[model samples]
Structure formats: C-alpha cells, structure tokens
Target: MKRLLILAALLPFTALAAPLNVDNNPNQPGYEIPSQQRMQSRMLNQQQQNKGMLNQQLKVQTQQQQQHLQNQMNNNQQRIQQTQPGMLNTPSTKPVAPRNGDMLKQY
Candidate 1:
C-alpha cells in the first residue's frame, strides 16, 4: 500500500531526533571543557619543579660535608706534627750525671 511505504520512510528519522544519553557516554565530558586538563598539567609541572630543587639542595649539602671532613683531617695532621716532631720512641728527657757509684766501675 502507498500509506505503508510512506510510514516506513519516516520511521527511521524519529530515532535520530531522540535525545542522547549524556550520563552513559564517557567521551562527552572531556571534550566539552578544557579547564580540567589545564589544571592537571599545571600540577604535574609543579611536582617536577619541586623534585629538581630538592636534588640541587642534596648535592650542595653533600659537597659541604665532604669539605668539612677534609678540613678536619688537615687540622689533625698539623696537630700531630706540632706535638711530636722528632722523639717518637723516647719515653722521657732525663739527665745522665756522674755519681759515686759510677766512679768505682771501670769505664
């Protein structure tokens, strides 16, 4: 029949006019707004900058500790040289004077 053919042609268009289900779709929200993407990118950049600063500070602290240890070693070496320069094995610097007990013994 002619009426049945016309009705069938108009039937497919009705489905296209229906409202889309926005809640069930995943790709709809991100494409609609760009501010959320920008915020996430800024947070990632800030974390990387903080990590770089921490590494630089750690290197400076290590250098300072090494320099302090070297200075201490040099100071200790200088002290040892000043305290005992020549007499390492001798116990005391006592005098040897001739007495009556030494005169009876043969030289």
Candidate 2:
C-alpha cells in the first residue's frame, strides 16, 4: 500500500519531466504548435477582412441615410414655395375722414 501511494506521487512528476516533441510526429497524439499558430493567424486575417467589409457597408448606409434626409428637406422646401408664391402685402395705416359733420357746426 505504501509503494502504491509512492508510485502515484511519482507518476505526476515523471509525466512532467518527459519533454513533448516539437516535431509533429504523427506517431505521437499531441497537438502541433506550428499548425495551431498558422490557423490562429488565418483566423485573425479573416477577422480583419470581415471588419473592413463591415466598415464599407456602414459608410454606404450612412451616405444613403444622408441622401434620403436631403431629398425630404428639398421636397418640404418645394411645398412651402408652392403654398406661398409671393411676399404678403402690408395693410394701409392711413386714417379715414368722417363724412357729413353738419351736427358739429350747429352745436
């Protein structure tokens, strides 16, 4: 029982002492670091490309929105012009004179 316990304790240390192969030996079942690195780089590159495409799409959408707003403003201005063709004339400020004031002369 003591030997079994000692073996179990040394087993973890023995596994740590063994060096994993840098060479992707097909016989060994460990992961290949170089392949993983290449895949990560490819993923990063694809992400950058996707971001660029999104930026382009956003710019196009913004331009379309601005154009739509500008068109609406132009239509509103045209409607206002159609409603009022000319400047409004001002009212006359001159006072009217009273007609036939013979009562005042008699008084």
TM-score of each: 0.50, 0.51
lDDT tens digits by residue: candidate 2, 3-42: 9999999999878656554355656676557778899999
lDDT, each prediction: 0.81, 0.82
TM-score, structure 2 vs. true: 0.51
Give the best candidate by lDDT. 2
lDDT tens digits by residue: candidate 1, 32-80: 3457778988999999999999999999999999999999999998878
Which sections of candidate 1 miss by over 4 Å?
1-33, 87-107
**Per-residue lDDT for 43 in model 1?**
94
Candidate 2, residue 5: Cα displacement in angstroms equals 48
Q: In candidate 2, how many clashes are counted?
A: 0
RMSD, candidate 2, Å: 12.5
